[model samples]
Target: MTIKEKADEILYKTGLYEELKTYGEPHPIGSYRMDMMVYNDLDIDILNNSMTLEKLHTLTNYILKTFRPTWYEAREEVNDEGKTVWFHGFHAILMDELWNFDLWFFDRETITKAEAYCDTITTRCHQNPTLKTTITTIKKDLLTKGLYHYDKYTSMDVYHAVLTENITTTQAFLKTHPLTTY
Candidate 1:
């Protein structure tokens, strides 16, 4: 099935079925809209807070859901007017693929603008001593075991581990770090 179908199925199962709205489009068919407002809940507190693991966990899960894997690369972009706002989305290849799910996260932020968000992720995966190891381990495990690896009862398998453990790590990181607000 297609991503839109999968998303619709998820919404239906979750009982979040809502009316679809439409507006004039920049192109021919017309612009369609939906109330996929989950990203709206990502308040500024999520950025400026020093919680490391919490922020990371939140970010990863977010990207995974908002921009599920497709034939496109995931990206974090920004648009600045006197201020700046961040967007977590996929290129049109993925965008078109998941059009029904509204595959983009519009996070209107000041400090954690698109550039900063990208930089933060880069630093964690590349610069930080401990984080680099953590990310590497996760990637290796993901590659070795593929989809079901995370479900394995092993502490080393980071990605397939329990969801609550992920939450705990995220909360702990947030408690230890200071992600300054914009």
Candidate 2:
């Protein structure tokens, strides 16, 4: 199946999208939001300020009961904005492939600013196909070479490398943007 179809299957068919809506507004980010799919992942940020233990428990419970995730983790922390945030991350075997999801739970105000920033990036890429192509190539090349790591780099890094730094190749990205930069 295609990338969008796979996302639809996991989000819509599996009812995760609707379930997330009950708590907050869930939306895509990074490559998924920009339609620059080069990896088996989805990045969703859910906006909710009043996140209660019961709400979290119910959502996670639903996920655990409804889906068979190969890996699952939940954590609460203070974000860079000094706002309390929660993260629900998981990887599941879907369509015979490992699919990763980053479910960031944050207050609506905090997430709105982030979403707006992502929107700017998305719009910029959409308006310039050549820029978008350059971006996806760098991302795909790095992933294919096993250069991307969860603890190291991300698609956002690639975008930053290209859009801001004008670095287009995999080598340049690795050389210019170090692990610490991410």
Candidate 3:
């Protein structure tokens, strides 16, 4: 199955969205939103400040027991926007493939700006249809060369390169910005 198909299976069929609704709204972001998915990575943005520390744990517990992911982790960190977030990320072998899920929890105040930024990227990718192809190519090449590390960069960086700047090739991307681990 394609990534979209598997995504739907995991999102709706697994009742992931319904479970998430107990805490807040679940909004898929990044490449998933832009239809530029190059790998088995899913990004979710949860807003409304409804997911408190306690609720976050309860939800994660449910995920752990139900999904039985190979591994999972949680963190509290400040985003690039300087807004603190509760991040619950996990990796699992699902549908005979390894999938990464990034669940970002944010308050209403923080989500407003975050959603707008993601929407802008989605809009830009939609406008320039070719950008999606270029993005997937760049991402696929990076992955093939073992140069694309999730910890080092994000889809936002990729979108920024293709949308704001004219950086295209993986070589150009590497030279233009230091896509390295912190």
Each model's TM-score, in the order given? 0.24, 0.90, 0.86
Per-residue accuracy of model 2 over 1-182 as CA lDDT, tens digit each? 77866887888998899999998889777667777888788888898887877877887888788778889987778877788888888888888899998898877676678778778888887788778888889878888888676767777788788889988778888889766652
Q: What are the lDDT figures for the candidates, one per model?
A: 0.32, 0.82, 0.79
The worst-scoring run of ten residues by lDDT in candidate 3 lies at 48-57
Backbone clash count, each prediction separately: 14, 0, 0
Q: Please give the TM-score that candidate 1 achieves against the real structure.
A: 0.24
Q: Which stretches of candidate 1 lie over 4 Å from their true place?
A: 1-30, 34-57, 62-68, 71-78, 91-182
> Which pairs of residues have clashing backbones in candidate 2?
none
> Taking the tens digit of each residue's C-alpha lDDT, what string does model 1 give over 1-182?
54334444543453323211011111111011111111111111112213234443454465456446343333344445542222233322232333322223333244335445434444443554554454344444433544212243222233223222442243343343324456
RMSD of 1: 17.0
Ranking according to lDDT, highest score first: 2, 3, 1
Clashing pairs in 3: none
Q: What is the lDDT of candidate 1?
A: 0.32
Give me the candidate number with maximum lDDT: 2
